[model samples]
Target: MSDFATNARLATAALRDLFDPTPLQRNDHLSAQYDAEIWLKREDLAPVRSYKIRGAVNAMRKVRATNPAQQVFVCASAGNHAQGVAYACRHFGVQGTIFMPVTTPQQKIEKTRVFGGDSVDIVLTGDYFDQTLAAAQNFCTDQNAHFLSPFDDPDVIEGQASVAVEMLEQLGRAPDLVVLPVGGGGLASGVTAYMRAESPKTQFRFVEPVGGASLTAALAHDGPTTISRVNSFVDGAAVARLGVCTYDFLKWVDPAHVLLAPEDRICVTMLEMLNVEGIVLEPAGALSVDVLPELSDQIRGKAVVCVTSGGNFDFERLPEVKERAQRYSGLKKYFILRMPQRPGALREFLMMLGPDDDIARFEYLKKSARNFGSVLIGIETKSADNFRQLFDNMGKAGFSFRDITADEALAEFLV
Candidate 1:
């Protein structure tokens, strides 16, 4: 075996002491939908509810083995990585100091604390993740402690390869295609490297959030480069830049195989999995599955595996998710209407709505002229064609309106 295969196998064996291998189950729903043998590697079911635990455990274990006196570890994360490090620290009986952004959710903070118990300290410092990460690194250097990078380190990448080890072992044979979600590139690079060594014939596809496609940017630029802006809605996979170490491993990937998933469209997939398959996936976790439709022709009659990265979803965000899903599917719309300042005008508009059409929001913005007023309206209907019919009816009735559903700035401000 090559050095990478040996190390990856050893890492996988060590992970057995932490938690059982995550399930690799054939998904009937997806299989039928795409006419392919579809399987899901449920990394979401890991002890930390993510594959992050594998990297954390392996990295910490190797560090301790090399230097027995290194007892302190530090890391910065706002979600899964924080919990993974905390759990690993508790398991090894070592002290850990975790730094998180002040804007992190309370639920994540509490979960990290619970996992570490008395073995870790949580520090809420910066408003942004970059600020928190900088503070943590400075602290680690000042105290002469080891800093665990979320995905940039070699040990962490090798540890993450454990996922591919378990995947092949569970499936018993090489899958035709493996679809992976890419963020900082830890999981993708690790799995791709290991698979390339073990099953050279296997093909790979990578998915990234459209607004935070760092891997795509790296491949285009021939190196890791920072993106100016990132949409954090898919918080798990929304990285501004690909890590130098990870990019090196993934630099040879084909640009065509890297799929970009729109943030709103991912919400539609999340809702579908939750409602149909009884699977709860966070936005980032749904990335691989979200692009499956686009690959329908390519994936037909083949065996495919999608890595469901994590299920650390907060139910409080359900409403926002539903709204985005509806908007993306064209079942919901928002518009500003010019309403005549006359008696019974409201009733006239209300009568124009079809049976399936429901008013989700209505507000009179201003009565600027003596004969007309501005009104904001949000409508939800059963189909996109309903909006077309409604608009046609309104136009015939002398109603003028501007659709703001696709206008990000206007929708953010008014809706």
Candidate 2:
């Protein structure tokens, strides 16, 4: 075996002291859909509900080994990374202080504390992630703590390689393709390195959230570059910039092999997994599989492995997820209706609805004049065609309306 692959195997074997390997299961549902043998590397089922624990545990192990006097580890993260570090801290009985943005979700904060128990202190600081990270790093320097980076460190990358190690052993051979989700690129770096030396024949497709296409941006520039803004909807995989170390390892990836997933389109995949396969996937976790439809022609009749990176989904987001999915599938729409200022106007509009159509929302904004007014309406139905029929009926009836479901500015202002 190659040296890096050998080292990765050793790292993985040592991890047995922590937890067993996550499952590599053949997903028949996805397989049939794409006409391929689709297997899922279920890192989402790991102890911290993500492969993050692998890197955290391994990084700490290396740190403690080289510096026997090291007792405290520090990190800044809003979700999985914090939990991973916290869990590792408790396991190793070491002191840890984690930093998170003030806007961090309560569930994530609680989960991190729960994993660390009394071994870690959760520090809520700053309103944004960049500011929070700065505070953590400065604090780490002041206290002489080992700052555990979520993805940049070499040891963390090695630890992430453990996933590939387990996959190779489980599969007995390399698959035709490996689909990976990239955020800061720690996991992708490790997996890609191992695959290069060990499973060289296997192809790769890297997925990034469309709004946070750091890796894609980096590859295009031939170096790491910061995006002006990033949408945080795919919180786990949304990064404004690729890590320098990760970019070094991944700089050679072809831009064509990188796929960008739209946030709303990702919601569709999340709903599919939840409803059809009974799998709960966070937006980032669903990224790899979300590309299947786009890559259908290329991946057909091949062996493909998609790594479902995490499942730390907050049930509170379920309603939002459903809404986005419905909208993306064309089954739901929001519109500004030009209603006649008559008492029976709503009744006339209601009569235009088809059998499967239901008015999910209806509110009169204000009366403009004695003869006219405006209403905000939301309609949901069984099929996209229902909206076409409804619109046709409205046009014939002379009731004008504008669909605001896809109007980003208007959706934010009103919806």
- In terms of TM-score, the best-performing candidate is 1
- What's the TM-score of each model vs. the native? 0.99, 0.99
Which runs of model 1 end up more than 4 angstroms from their true locations? 367-369
Q: For model 2, state the Cα shift of residue 318 in Å.
A: 0.2
lDDT for each residue of candidate 2 in 1-415, tens digit (9 for 90 to 100): 7887888888898889888999999999999999999999999999999999999999999899999899989999999999999999999999999999999989999999999999999999999999999999999889999999999998899999999999988999999999999999999999999989998999999999989999988988888899999999999999999999999889889999999999999999999999999999999999999999999999899999999999999999999999999999999999999998878878988899999999898888876557777889999999999998899999999998998999999988888
Badly placed stretches (over 4 Å) of model 2 are none
TM-score of 2: 0.99
Q: By TM-score, how accurate is candidate 1?
A: 0.99
Candidate 1 global lDDT: 0.95
Error of 1 at 140 (Å): 0.5
lDDT of 2: 0.94
Which lDDT tens digits does candidate 1 get at residues 1-415? 7898899999999988878999998999999999999999998888888889888999999999999899999999999999999999999999999999999999999999999999999999999999999999999989999999889988899999998998899899999999999999999989999999999999999999999999999999999989999999999999999999999999989999999999999999999999999998989899989999999999999999999999999999999999999999999999999999999998999999999999999998996678999999999999999999999999999999999999999999999
CA lDDT of each candidate? 0.95, 0.94
